[model samples]
Target: MKIFYPLIFSIFLFCYEISGQYYPSQEWERKSASSLNMSQPLLDSAINIASQNENAVNRDLRIAIIEAFSREPYFEILGETKERGGPAGLIIKDGYIVGEWGDIKHVDMTFSVAKSYLSTVAGLALDKKLIHNIDDKVYEYVWDGTFDGSHNKKITWDHLLTQSSDWSGQQFGLYDWADRSPREGEIDDWRARKLYEPGTHYKYNDVRVNVLAYSLLQVWRKPLPQVLKEKIMDPIGASTTWRWLGYHNSYVNVDGIKVQSVSGGGHFGGGIFINTLDHARFGLLFLRNGKWVEKQLISKDWVKSVQKSSKAKSDYGYLWWNNSQGSWEGVSKEVYYAAGFGGNYIIIDEANDLVIVSRWIDNSKIDDVVRLVQNSIK
Candidate 1:
């Protein structure tokens, strides 16, 4: 019986492996010849430049870098690095990795970086006319009694993308609320009411993005994860070892009824975790105007729209940060990025076809890193 038990366990493990239900080993393998060739000389030059930066060796910088690895919150979360720790990052210059740090195999959380990726998805949906336009009302698709009455009717897709929705306050607080209660009412109330006219003001709110996620799901009649895998992830050949947090919960309204919801329900929020190399690949697509290996992954026009500044916020577009160091002395005006909390970043310079990905420990000195990189570029 003991021998039979061991044999049964071995068979079960074999079946699990065949079914792709087990975690693969962390052996780092080069993506492909084409993907690898994207960053040769540029990476060499970047490494040379990075080696010379005083901040790279300075005590404060070194401490900050270490703390980033520890995911401390003493440092402010700016750019892609959030309060939470991020995954490894890949830097690509002229479509090739100039440098990489952290584990290339371990997937890191993308935080708001997911927002930028989702924006790309939105672009594709727009191309398919699944989403008509930026100005299309969100309620057009989510018309299920989830949101009803006055302010709900006024919310539009643009409002969510621009973070100009009236419910920004609730959305902002929803994160904290979710941490306390993972129940359905926790989410519904977060997106329950309109605090102001949609698009009249700008407020950074995660809930608005959640609303966008919900709308996309409804339009496609599938979950956001599945949609991404089919539309974006598979085509780009991104690492399959990634996960999207959030999108599961029920919200209870003031009326005390359970609302079936699958949007941004988590308070702290979730991100798309990916490895550094895969991130570089994703950044390469953006750098090439949404083309991957000569194939158009997303419409060029849609890419342009997402990269351009929205009317609501001069420094924000769709889900991308227009310029983290826009006004900084050394930062290039042409630089735009997909930034997340805990320093997870994919910084792209479209004009120069440069992409810099950095996954740092949470709460690192992002400003210094940004400054150092900017100075190096100069």
Candidate 2:
């Protein structure tokens, strides 16, 4: 009897996956607030909320990076850092731009939001069997000395995606321990500290995140940006203005051809420099459960996997942030997002059929932004 029910549910899910939907193309169609059955005033107020509360980071992003990560020993911007502009964002209700503010076309650094895109690359790898399973040890594919150590060899794709890898070692002149280390620790204390069993601890370390990028590069044997372009960005009809960059020293020879490895975030500098509309497109892809119109861009299973809470961090998934842990009180646990430094976000509210991208806004006000937008729906 139990097996019969399980089979019936599986058939229902399979049918749902093949369903089609309306999606945006190169020029996204916009609808009036009233057309979408949303409160005009309330929607305007929500847009104002995001446009007004700007992030406090310096306009000269070089200074901003220094001030933010200054505590780390000898921290410097190793990747590209450029001057940033004012707040910008978009609100997509049912795949249409229902609300927007600031320069939607302006190109700017999106910090750690790149991690979500990197996570998508991993999903594609899994879909195409470039990676057999997320549970497989990374050392099996990346036999290079990078994962040679006893501790690192224990790491898996799962651990890296969740930032729980606790992967030790240096990548591109940055040490894993030195990144976001404890405020009270001395250098030697961090260096000599006992390792956490891979996947047992969660730490937001850019060095380790970069290690994931480097490992993916090894598996793909091509530049990640090219992979992203072919597999994701282009298919979704994103603009050519965006770029995924890494450190000056991050380039390595892949099969005798020198290719650059991209960074997961804009921590020490280079990450995703993207505009708002492209972000909206990326968010929409996930909001639809990886289904774009009739084409399933990525597997439905991968989309679901990115939202599940991992053991180490209940509010974090494979590079996507979750509300399940109630970290953002009053927000629905079903709402998951891709967040980056300086208030960059690609928030997905599947319940509302919405994709909200808020950049350079006060990070604290994000929940209010979400709640207000949700309230605007009639």
Candidate 3:
């Protein structure tokens, strides 16, 4: 009798462990779908299109798109339609999600898409007096003494946003950091050096973004993730499961203490991972001018400022990329976008009231992808 009881107890424990490993609770399932809120008409159209579009690429093609450009081997493509291998991609027209694809119940990484989101957060911080101005030297908050004697001190939030920091950092090199984990000292050494006079030229560097993240921490007296959550994520009803990646492989930092960087930060920095549906929710937030449902998450002025292009050759703005082609195929030149390596994109056409988001594997022919997106809209 004693042996029988012990055996039964052991069996119960094993069963519980196995169930826990495979079964996501109802709460988790709900959290995964938290970002999915589409209007009926739009959802219906998306579903119809998804079902009928024979040329629509499959998951394999989507993965190929990202693998061509990114070091990461895996990817997910969410769309605003109900179809095979779909992840939830919220299609917003005039500020409401009308359709979704894939598992609307899953959250994904947004990668550099987080940059634009962070920029909006910074704008809100400024409006609330949490941050002063774009021209304010970042060293004012996090004084590392490196910018003191160099022209780099002139580098401001404005410069970083516009990708005009003039630091001579290569965009592809920054994108490659996902595979190469450099030491802290190496990163610090690079930070200390000025590639060009601040605000005098344009360069793309992920390290500059890290500095931005660190500056936010210094000024807010809270981690960047927390600031984002309270100021933007919660208001937008964003899922609590999301995260952002940061330097040193940490998510959130308090003074000297380090925590896991949020998935958004890590994915954008090439350290974290996520699902496709969450990406769409993020897009919806921007499409709605920072208003999510009943709350004003970010100021509209901030959104306009970040979306507009700076006086740079690349037509960049606060990490957002503006239309540089002037006109393509009679299409109006009023498009702005937030793009990432491995074919992640959030393109907003305010004039047309459209927001398009896609996640794919890295691809060498990014121009082809861009052209395809443009053609689709036309």
Which candidate wins on TM-score?
2
RMSD of candidates 1 onward, in order: 11.8, 7.9, 13.3
**Worst ten in a row by lDDT for model 2:** 13-22
**Superposition error at 234 for model 1 (Å):** 1.6
lDDT, candidate 3, 1-378, per-residue tens: 787998997875564234232111122122111243323443455444432332333344334334443443221222211112443344444444434454554544445676776676578778888768778876566565524545556777787666666533222224222323345456545445546666666655555665565556556766666777787666545566766555444344466775543322333333223455445556656666766554567778887887676765457788787775653334446777777544556777666556666554233332333343334332
Clashes of each: 23, 0, 37
Predicted candidate 2 versus true structure: per-residue lDDT over 180-276, tens digit per residue: 8767557788779999999998898899989999999999999999999998888888999999999999999999999999999999999999999
TM-score of 1: 0.67
Q: For model 1, how many clashes? A: 23
Off by over 4 Å in 1: 1-87, 168-194, 247-269, 361-378
Badly placed stretches (over 4 Å) of model 3 are 1-88, 95-99, 167-194, 247-274, 327-331, 361-378
What TM-score, to 2 decimals, does candidate 3 have? 0.64
Regions of model 2 farther than 4 Å from truth: 1-20
Residue 361 lDDT, candidate 3, scale 0-100: 26
Give Cα distance to truth, residue 327, candidate 2, Å.
2.3
Q: What range of 10 consecutive residues in model 1 has the weakest lDDT sum? A: 72-81
